[model samples]
Target: MSDSPHQMTPPPPEDEVSGWLRDRRGHFDQLVSSVEDYAIFMMSREGIILDWNRGAERLKGYTAPEIVGRHFSVFYSDEDRQSKFPDKELEIASAEGRFTVEGWRYRKDGTQFWASVTITAIRSESSAVEGFLKITRDLTEHRATDEMLRRSEERFRLLLESVQDYAIFMLDPEGHVMSWNNGARRIKLYEENEIVGRHFSIFYPPEAISIGMPGSLLAKALKDGRVEDEGWRVRKDGTRFWGNVVLTALHDSKGELRGFAKITRDLSDRQQVEHLRETGRRKDAFLATLAHELRNPLAPMLPGVDLLLHAPHDVATVTGIASMLKRQVDQMAHLIDDLLDMSRITAGKIALRHTVLPVREVVDTAVEASNPLIREFGHRLTLNLQDELMIEADPYRISQIISNLLSNAAKYTPPEGEIALTVSEKPGPMLEIRVTDNGIGIPKALQHSVFELFDQGASGSSGGLGIGLTLVRTLVEMHGGSIALFSAGEGQGCEFTVRLPVITTSAPAATGETPVIPSAPRSGPARILIADDGRNAADILGLFFQMEGMETAVAYDGEEAVKIAANFEPDFAFLDLGMPKLDGYEAARRIRRMYPRVILAALSGWGAEDDRRRSAEAGFDVHLLKPAKPDDLREVLRQHG
Candidate 1:
């Protein structure tokens, strides 16, 4: 009873509103629960989960019942747990109001995922510590995508560095080079350090820069997304070369202009090749025309010379005329043959009638051809050979090549000097043919161009065109052989060596039956058609045929021949392969069509294999090279006519 006074009565309730307090707290919890993209939860003072929402369940693969009572540390990966990141996060939150981090987290199944976590400390109204609340979002997919994109970009950069043949690089919008590839380095002869940051205009020639072509191209690319050009461009050394250039503008994500990608290719070599081809084609055409025009008249001259030789006259006068005719005709024939040979070689018409023949036979044939020329030059030729050395080659071409070499020796050698010709078996599958002359040697400067068409060196003589060596090279190479020219120096003598492959032997006879020289023609009148481009040639041919007791009609060009042949129905027709309106080949085709049975002979300066094939296809019965001797012409005509 004494202490009863000390018992205090229950104090009156302070001004408090219970229902509103509960309502506000419930609204805060509902706000946390409504966050669908973040794993929002509340933890107790002991780091245990106090509340879990749908966001937490969806992110961590757990329900409220499974995770609400669990310690918050369960969300940390093993490495994070060992490092005590969960406690550290709580400590930081307790001291600094909140702790936020992006790191790997774990699910209920223990698989890890990237998480963005924000932690906050909950405190009592009196400032007593309560628990931490954490919000986390799964960012694994987004982070993985970012990492993959980084790797892809690195790979693209590497790929650009490895390319060659194209100068692939980037330029800034202002036309400054920004990137360099290996191709750019090689073509510009500059390293990346030296080239990058330089203006792209530096690659253009000064003339191009004066015209603003470089800047203009950049502006075009920026406006139209791409620009292309080709012309002479300058290199680092100031040498100009042909270049093919392309520029493409780059853009950012929002389509704002970024930079340009430029590519350049060098084409100087291609330009040179096309130029040479054009030149060669023109020269071939001109020579072919000249030969046809010049040879058509010679055709009639041969027959006329034959008639004079047979006519009743003083033996001395007839002999004199005959000798003169033979000499002039021989010269003309040689010139025509040279022209035709060049044409045939260029047209790829020469056919190889390959035969296995003794190397000595070829030498002998070449020696005979060069004997007259050698005698004229007062040059001594020493012929040396190994017996029965056989080679597989076109006899005509090999003989022609050897003959050309011997003639060259005779033409260039000093009078009374010695020329040595040797045929020997070379080691391993080749027959070595060597012709060394004590003559005016080729200049060292001219050696490189010696084999080129029409390349002539200064021999102090001007009568011959410089085509023999070229023809020799062509024929030799066509036979899969090679030729080399050597000399001590100019005026010190020149030597040519030809090496040709040897075939397994069982060679042809050393000497074959001599070609049956055509007998003199019967004394009878015959009809003839003469086609030529030169008027003098046509008249000369007409006179010759008339003296031979043969009626001849002349046509100045191929077209006229076709017309005259159709009307006159001549038994013998000589059609020049090269004519003004219609070429000889075409005219031959037309005449053959009209008179299938008439003997069609092709007289051309071009006597290449391709020429022969085309003439044959066009129904020419015989292909005669220009400047043919009168007797030879008769032989060709008699066989075909």
Candidate 2:
């Protein structure tokens, strides 16, 4: 050992270390000064700016000499300076070793820019705070883009909340409901707490769920980006509604499934409107057929009447002609009655006269009414009656319903076919009437729709107005009963079953006496006025009243009727609703003001419930449809009399 401790080549002097650090600092300064995108500067521990780079000078529009020794708070906005944010930032940086924030800053020219800033504390070897290294970047454009995106999202959310017609919602990847909007609540009748986190399939009907339609729709949306469908959906209350649905698949930037956006609109009203349009078209067709049907009977009646008028007065010849005329007239009347019944049913104007009646009587009446047609078709008929069965029903309408079914069977069945009508009592206090025929049957497609208006079976070759079954269904429903039809297909026999609630009460007392309508006393010849737009109709009606021992006046228009009534002071007036020159409504009002005691009656082709309401409002006591039978007019006269 040459000398004392083997000295490591005397440790580098402290001066040398200091020189090396200074050189590194110079290099860092050069590196930072060269950058133009970010402003780099130095601040004293007191928040006073000391050094500024080229980037800082360019961004703040201040030269190094102009900014040096200035307070760094000059770069902050006035509000931030008032709040002492610059000092707080420096204090926080010194204590925590660093502070970063983004906010508004001012340039030398007083202009503003959004800025991202970072302040890092410098420390001495003794761990004492020395100064701060500050880095800032102008981010006005990025801030603007972010603000625009935030506002756009807010607008979309508001739009979804405000919508009332369409249900807009989101679903998770597995079809769980994620979000629901106001419209979703309105349409689907579900609150967010009740629906969210549940499966989206809750909106599907049982039939749709059975077929996995909700999952299928999701899959289709995922595969095709979007899917649209129109079908029936169930509400929270389990009532079904027609819905127009659209499902759109959502994806991340990588094209992976994120979820789905579902939009649903209730289309029940639109569907109803379309149904009405379809019904109108069918009604037009039915009307055309009705014209032909009316002509069919009228054609024969005209020739037969001509023959009777010109032929010899032989007893056999007169009797045969009279029978033929009666048959044709009866046929025409039957057709007209059916048309009127359908109209009344559609207008909700048919009032049922309900009573407890024996089922046997109902069956017998229907059978008797249908006998002529059954014989004409040569069908073998069978009847099985449960004599103990009684139902609270509109006896006439019940008989009509059964007669319609029987007639339908006779018309569809081939000659010599077999038909059976059976009555049975079920345990639910219900009575069932089944009518079956070995005839050309309804197609399977039509079985469900056979009760709809103008829905004729495929095998319905026998011409008809196609309203009989509709009327039957309506009448059955009015009695709180239901009717169902079953058929395998065309050429297979069909069965129609009707079920009605049974009444436990005894049958009503029967009275063979007919009702006698009391007529007005003929103090003198009763004065009457007839108003109609149809000249011939007015004259003929007037003549009929005259023949019935009444003084009558005829007017061609409502205005003329009012004028005539001003002088005639008639005891009764029949006003047509659709006469030219001031309609019957106005005419009646005027006549009522002048002669309040006159018995007013409305005679018009318009026979709807609304029509009757208008007539009553116009002071009419009676409303009769056009082509009123003589007996109906006589009955009205008798009541008023």
Candidate 3:
């Protein structure tokens, strides 16, 4: 293999190079003239048209022979020509090497359209300005599209600004406020100047801001395209209001992060209205419960009074009727007392009478009170008492709390179920009482609300006012104790634990139980007035009073009672609280004015503390719930006579 030297060719001569350049210019001209999108042409340094291509003919609507030597200024509108814009374009291109702009251009037919033009000044070998190469593109359609887009954006901006209920605004990709609208000002209580450029977290609560919630929301929106949330938001004045917000991420055609669009609505007023409606529903439920509880005691009293009146000679029957009446009266009083106690508890008007007592004593009293129910349900009671375990608490309320819990367990549990009450002293000077039952357990969803008033569980088939647990919790808390309930869902049974702080003190002296007093003997025939809206209630009660050695006069309404009392000159008057024409309060005031010494009493279904206070204010000596017992009446008469 012989290594031979590479040979190099010599450069072309000047004459051959000039010929090649000329051929290339011809080819470039042909290519430019073939294009139809842009008008390619040439203008002399004097602003005269030198050459025109097919594109120029198509764009300017002129043939080569008709427009070749014409002034290039003819392509401009008359006003542009008058302003010498065409001449100025040449001067700028000559001085700066090129001039490019978009402006109006004229066609051969006297019509005008938008165009983009570029003029490049050609220079000779001597650096002298030669002809100019001008290229123009008809941009009329593009201009029309741009105008439509501009109008659309204007309309969108106006729509957002006009909204009053929604805070429509914009934020940067970094969660900074960008633009504010009228609705934003109205809802957020900040002016555009004050809010723009600030972090969007300003609208969030302090707690939410501290947790970087606003930034998290922005990131979520960017990932998910949109995010919606409802929560508390702060206004410019620092007042809190509920807000419903939607955040939508904005992006460009290239998928570049632009910003976000945030729309917020103030829902505080709507939330308040919904709350009030819920309260109204609870009130309606309570009223229905009140009606049901009242009728329970009244149902049995009706026939007991009838038997006593129609069979007075049957001592055995009379005694049975008297006992039944007494039991029913006590039941009614208990129902009324529960209602009043709940009211006082809710109003924070109840006071606890604290005393040192052994927990065994409280447990014994509660077990005694609940023994009947336990036996009725056939439940086996188990007691785990720590001997001498003591606490300083309200003895009566504590006993009531324990009794209610035991009673609840008995009622909810099936027959032959087991109930255990355990009392123990825990550390920290705390006394714990746990009541457990193998009963129908509360549902998981309702366990949290079991202590709420009027909340009834699925096991509430046994009749109750639904306030037992409410009272239990209220009384336990009043004694500086806490109560908690646990259940393993439905049918898994339940356990309630109560913990109270214990104190070191000597146990109080135990008082003797008061003896039940016997009913007094009816002295002599005494006049009485009875007023009630319910005819059955008034007639039955009047018959019993008449049988008890009292002259009874009946009236169905307050007005009738007042008229009857004036004529009868009754020594005692009973007025119903709710009656037509006149109410019990007014009737009592009028009757007391007429007969200053009459022992006035109120008879009504309502037995709230306020009812009693109103009765006293209206001159009633005593307030009695409806279906009053004959023995209670005889006792009152015995005292007055």
Winning model by lDDT: 2
Across residues 1-641, which tens digit of lDDT does each residue of candidate 2 receive? 01112110121233333333333445456567657788887666677665667778889888776776678999887888899989999999999999999989999999999999999987777777767789999999999999999999999999999999999999999999999999999988999999999999999988889999999999999999999999999899989889999999999999889999999999999999998998898778777878888888888788887887888687788789878876676677778788888878867888876677787888889999899889998999999887887777788888999999999999999999999998888777788889999899877766867787876667542657888899998888888889999988888988999988755567665655555332244568879999999998899899999989999999999999999999998888988889899888899999989887788889877666677888998899889877766777898788776
- Span of ten consecutive residues with least summed lDDT in model 1: 1-10
Q: Is candidate 1 or candidate 2 better by lDDT?
A: 2
Question: How do the residues 1-641 of candidate 1 rate in per-residue lDDT, one tens digit apiece?
Answer: 12121111121122321232223334446577656688887666567775666678778988666665668888777787899978888889998889999888888898889999999877766665566678899999998998899999889888878878878999988989899988888788888999889898899877788999988998899889899998988878888878888899999999988889998988789878976885586457546645654565467667767767677486775777667666556756665677677876777766788777777777778788778878988888888888867777777778888888888888788788899988888776787889998788888877777676655555532234567888998888887889998987888898999987755477574555445332224355667888889787777778877887788899999888888888887777778777899988888778877766667778776566666888898888788776445676677565654
Error of 1 at 641 (Å): 7.3
Q: Where in model 1 is the C-alpha error above 4 Å?
A: 1-325, 343-351, 356-361, 443-446, 458-462, 502-539, 542-571, 575-598, 637-641
Candidate 3 displacement at residue 33 in angstroms: 2.5
RMSD of 1: 17.1
Report the C-alpha lDDT of model 3 over 277-364, residue by residue, as the tens digit. Answer: 8667766776787788778878989988888789989999998887877766776776777877887888877778777778888889
Residue 117 in candidate 1 has what lDDT?
A: 90
Per-residue lDDT value at 265 in model 3? 95
Sorted on TM-score, highest at the top, how do the candidates line up? 2, 3, 1
**Between prediction 2 and prediction 3, which has the larger lDDT?**
2
Candidate 2 TM-score versus the reference: 0.59
lDDT of 2: 0.83
